[model samples]
Target: MADWGAIGAVKSAVNIPVIANGDIIDAPSASRALELSGADGVMIGRGAQGQPWVLAQIAAELAGQVYRGPQGHALADVILKHYEDVIRFYGPDLGVRNARKHLTWYLERLEGGMELRNLIIRERDASVVLKRLTEGLKNCGPIIEVAA
Candidate 1:
């Protein structure tokens, strides 16, 4: 939504590539948005927040290609690293707070995530959050939670 205007306007004004950013969550949406905005390419932002493979998905579909999602353990590691990055970016207090939401999301992708999410929210700081998240991983046994 945020980049629609710029994308549309740029597409209209120049022959260069006009990449639309924001709110492109899937292949249909990506194609529809480009069609609507008359843009050359789409640049997704938050839509790929937790699902990094979304970019490849869109790219593949739009480019008449196929894209497979990340592997299980590989995806888990990506998610865990994402939490660590968030903690590093936002610091322990805000980071831990932010990680809470992300952890919930990560948990949902697994089997029994609600309990783990509930347990994680109780953590007060980054270290505790990380610990709880790790514990959740170990104790909950393969729960992929996605925060709402």
Candidate 2:
């Protein structure tokens, strides 16, 4: 749980905007944090993990807008694009190493993903990782069409 009381004290003592942070994972948590802290806003850190859409989801809740997370091919597209960018920036070897955590996070929620995630995380070659990932997505159903 977050120390929302401490945050309230800070808000009362300061004239500047106080943004409550830590442990805010969803709309309900974010709302509760603000109600308790009386802060101007909240910040999301680890909540993003594999699901980058969390920020948008929370924001929409605040604004009373309807939004849903990406799924199926959309999810595959986001994951694949992120992997490609990481590889481009870090090169094949280091990229594969760095991307394991993110991939692990992304795939953890997928049905029947444990063995596939373990395989991808252990592989050293970037090409093989990408191949396995693409194939793994296919195995899940509705394969992502990565643009060539």
Candidate 3:
């Protein structure tokens, strides 16, 4: 954050909210980021991936409130949505090609994800990729488990 001192200073001097980006990927970091930037708020990017609740958590914490997302399927659903969005945004060939990155990103959060990530990277067919992803989701076990 200190590395962005000049940008922060300019924004502060101008009385405009100078949102700092990069590096900060979690709530704790977001708080420290606010202190470091001396700005009005923090901007979350990759940190919010697979965790849409991150924004809410940061906002809640900043407001002096306790924040926690519902445990089961919360992370998985978001990752799935991200994958769908990628496919939707990019189309099959390009989407699947582009999906490699997001797929890797999604799988990285899963246990034993590296192996799956490697497989995804090697795959060339879009349908195969989606199939493997569905299978991976099933075999990888519940991202969120509800205790009976």
**For model 2, which pairs clash?**
none
lDDT, each prediction: 0.73, 0.84, 0.68
Q: Choose the strongest candidate by TM-score.
A: 2
Better of 1 and 2 by lDDT: 2
Task: Give the per-residue lDDT of model 2 (tens digit) for 1-148.
Answer: 7898789999999899999998998899999999999999999888888789989989998899967778788888898899999999999889989999989877776765556798788899988999899888766643222211
State residue 42's C-alpha deviation in candidate 2, in Å: 1.1
Note each model's CA RMSD in angstroms: 3.6, 5.5, 5.0
Ranked candidates, highest lDDT first: 2, 1, 3
> RMSD of model 3, in Å?
5.0
lDDT of 1 by residue, 1-148 (tens): 4556556776778877777767788899888888778887778776775577788988898889998776556666777788899989998778888777677556666676667778777778677767666666655455343553
lDDT of 2: 0.84
Worst 10 residues of 2 by lDDT: 139-148
Candidate 3, which segments miss by more than 4 Å at Cα? 1-7, 49-52, 69-72, 141-148
Question: What TM-scores do the predictions have?
Answer: 0.73, 0.88, 0.76
Task: Please report how far candidate 2 places residue 141 from its true position, in Å.
Answer: 6.0
